[model samples]
Target: MNEKIPQQSLKGCKPEIHYPCVWQYKVIGMERQAIQAALSKKLGDAPYSLSESRTSKQGKYISLNLELTVHNEEQRLHLYSALTADPSIKLVL
Candidate 1:
């Protein structure tokens, strides 16, 4: 005898797919580790990765690239706002 699965079993079982959002910051007046620490404190436990590089031909400032898993526009905007509000952050993209 063959068994049939109930349709209700699949209800509310839709898969969730997350897309990584990237933010590039031309950060100044602070070290990369400090920025990363600040971000971690602001964004909480959300999964993220950071990469930083000093600009070519200039040792005055550095750029930080942040990769995070975001669910909606609000989250992205919030992150941008928080980063921009910091005095050490020069630019955000």
Candidate 2:
């Protein structure tokens, strides 16, 4: 027998986000240069700001805070997906 999982509704749970707004993404990676290279390859000449957020306790990883203006939800999501899919990027928040 197969069991069906209930789906949750987001009717009133999601926060309202205005389009063409600046969005911040925290990207974690093993190396800063690699992360920057990956971002550059993915984002091309798009305007963005990147800065060091924090370093891991052991100093094996680094997190970069990237801020960019997204035109819409699709653009935001697409960039998130691209960043997350990069080999150098370990996580995106």
Candidate 3:
């Protein structure tokens, strides 16, 4: 199911970003395998790095830091939206 999240309004001017830059995203989920699977499905054979960030106090949830190069704003936002919408992903930052 696709869930709609309330979009946050920008209060100030957006920051300038150079194109074809490396971007990092912190993804939280219940299982690492599911998260990896989701990422693999969406990102194909793209060169990226994934590292363990942290785990919940009870060790129930896991957060992974994902770093990848994005060619443009559209690619970055599209990946963010896709990851956030995935059931395996609890949150993305």
Candidate 4:
């Protein structure tokens, strides 16, 4: 799902990012409700925005764009890891 990702890093160099920034993550799953539940479990009471992206032609899968403010790279990666670890979530990008 990372099609044509932007070149943020060069080899081993990490991209510089300001702290407490809003990040966007594309979460793909089987069902809308299931995706919401999984996100709730992972995010707790944290505020976030979730919007439908698109569904497979057969309606087998759905992708949602999730936006939330991350305090640092660690928090951002932690959230990504949590989303990927959920059984209901198929992929995160």
Candidate 5:
């Protein structure tokens, strides 16, 4: 279970994030379609928004902004792990 720490104590340790809140991930990869498929496969029925971000001048790489609701730190971290594990995904922020 996740315990909430008072705002005043946030400076002493980990930053406090309310659960079931929207989270964002910046996904960088070579192809937009591959990233989209990976997101769809991993998220399943979860609702999310995916948009184009920066792209290399030579068109070798691109970044996509991903926004979705994450219930807790575990789920958030799990998503990051799964995304980074994909071969089509180069980086996740």
Candidate 6:
């Protein structure tokens, strides 16, 4: 006869986690390098990556794609707060 396993036998299973949340930023009156530096400082030693591009309509603005490899939702919130606090950063998306 076949027998079924008891409940709680699969307690070792772990849920999956997503990494490197993608974020975009709209920054005005700031150079690419300056934004990068500011982000680097805010992230501390965690080592995040960024991509930047420029767009013009009525004036010049720089768009940045930020990647955080080891940050959670709360951490992401903090990062956004920090970036927005900077005078050079016009917007965070």
| Top-lDDT structure, candidate number | 3
Candidate 3 error regions (>4 Å): 1-10
For model 2, name the residue pairs that clash: none
TM-score of each: 0.63, 0.86, 0.87, 0.87, 0.84, 0.61
User: Which of the predicted structures, 1 or 2, would earn the higher lDDT when compared with the native?
Assistant: 2
lDDT of 4: 0.95
Off by over 4 Å in 4: 1-9
RMSD of each: 12.1, 7.4, 8.8, 5.2, 6.8, 10.8
Per-residue alpha-carbon lDDT of model 1 for 1-93, expressed as tens digits? 898979999798955544444444444445666677677777888777776756535666667777766766677678788888877666777
Candidate with better lDDT, 2 vs 6: 2
Residues 4-72 of candidate 5 have per-residue lDDT tens digits of: 868787666866899999999999999999999999999999999998989989999999999999999
Clashing pairs in 6: none
lDDT of 2 at 81: 94
The 10-residue segment of model 6 with minimum total lDDT is: 20-29
Query: Runs in model 2 with CA error above 4 Å?
Result: 1-12
Error of 3 at 42 (Å): 0.6
Each model's total of backbone clashes: 0, 0, 0, 0, 0, 0
Model 1 stretches with alpha carbons more than 4 Å out: 1-29
The better-scoring model by lDDT among 1 and 4 is 4
Q: TM-score: which candidate is best? A: 3
Cα displacement (Å) at residue 28, model 3 = 0.3
Question: Could you tell me the C-alpha RMSD of candidate 2 in Å?
Answer: 7.4
Residue runs of model 6 more than 4 Å from their true location after superposition: 1-29
Instruction: List, residue by residue over 1-93, the lDDT tens digit for candidate 6.
Output: 898868698588754556555544554445676777777778778755676655657546777777655456676667778889977677787
- State the RMSD for candidate 1: 12.1
| RMSD value for candidate 6 | 10.8
Residue 62, candidate 4: Cα error in Å is 0.2
Candidates sorted by lDDT, descending order? 3, 5, 4, 2, 1, 6
